[model samples]
Target: MALDRTKDSGNNSSQATGNWKPIGCEEKRAAVHVEMERVNKLPANSSYATHRLRVLNKVLHLISIQRTASQNEELELLFAGISL
Candidate 1:
């Protein structure tokens, strides 16, 4: 459920479900390379493709954080029960 009410026609909704991890600093640049792997689709060095990949990478990072926080909470609960 992505709500896109903006002047720009292009609106993308990105979300991840299931286990996730923290995306470190290098993840962003590595994402660029991974995106570049699908080179044939885009004209060589297309700026739009580059920007899209960056945006996707950032969204993934955020989603990873969400999953990580949830996992941490679950782990804390488990540990508390064990110590009890």
Candidate 2:
């Protein structure tokens, strides 16, 4: 009997799910840097600046979480291959 392996192929999640590609830390950081520069150009006390700053802070927090999760996943994979 033959076995099926279509879904087992090493394609990325974007291909399996939809057209959108996953954003990595570099892209996210670049976006944050660009937004920060724009916000800095605005008046210090302006409401829009404050709002953008808040959103940027949240993005930074999420990036931190993503980095931690990726590290944890690597560690888990490493340990998973070890013998007891």
Best by TM-score: 2
Estimate, for each residue in 1-84, the C-alpha lDDT of model 1 and write its tens digit.
784444334222122232345455355446545654664388758887676555554444543564577765553443333221
Model 1, clash count? 0
What is residue 23's positional error in candidate 1, in angstroms? 22
After TM-score superposition, the amount by which residue 51's alpha carbon in candidate 2 deviates from its true location, in angstroms, is 1.4
Give candidate 2's TM-score. 0.52
Q: Candidate 2 — which residues are off by over 4 angstroms?
A: 1-18, 66-84
| Candidate 2 lDDT, 1-84, residue by residue in tens | 754444545566446555675556677667777877878899999998897777676565655664577765653443233211
Q: What is the C-alpha lDDT of each candidate?
A: 0.49, 0.62
How far does residue 70 in candidate 2 sit from its true spot (Å)? 16
Clashes of each: 0, 0
TM-score of each: 0.31, 0.52
